[model samples]
Target: MKPVNIGFNNMVMDERIVAIINPDSAPSRRLREEAKLENRLIDATLGKKTKTLIITDSNHVIMSAINPETISLRIGKGE
Candidate 1:
């Protein structure tokens, strides 16, 4: 699997990622809350403010401090 760096030394499998969203959005917030309730949330923010929410095909939600645009760029470059 190709892994892409999301930031702060964090990397996620590129193929498994279904969506990268801004954390401030209402839908994203709800998604996070649901993921938390389902125990499918993975905190990758490392105590920093969350900038992006990564939704995976396996139903895992990852919080990242890095912006979604930056992560998209990394994915575009296949890094």
Candidate 2:
């Protein structure tokens, strides 16, 4: 991924910035297993409250879960 320029309006000095980058690697068996478990949980729960974000590298390898709902809430608050 690339650092997206947000123009000068909101730009400020000394502000921390974050970026997401993907690399080349195959999905690990452990990740596949976890996803399968999560899927089963969702299915068993009948999608009562299910949210999963599996961000993988360029080669579809699971890197790490950034954040779940807290991140969503932060973005929502920013908006």
- The C-alpha RMSD of each candidate to the native structure, in angstroms, is 0.8, 13.0
When summed lDDT is taken over every stretch of 10 residues in candidate 2, the lowest stretch is: 6-15
Clashes of each: 0, 0
Minimum summed lDDT over a 10-residue window in model 1 is located at 1-10
Write candidate 2's Cα lDDT for 19-63 as tens digits.
222222243345445656665211211323222223333222222
For candidate 2, the lDDT comes to 0.30
lDDT (Cα, tens digit) per residue for candidate 1, span 1-79: 7899988888999999999999897998999999999999999888999999999999999999998899999999999
Candidate 1 overall Cα lDDT vs. reference?
0.93
Model 1, runs deviating above 4 Å:
none
Model-by-model lDDT, in order?
0.93, 0.30
Q: What would the TM-score be for candidate 2 when compared with the true structure?
A: 0.21
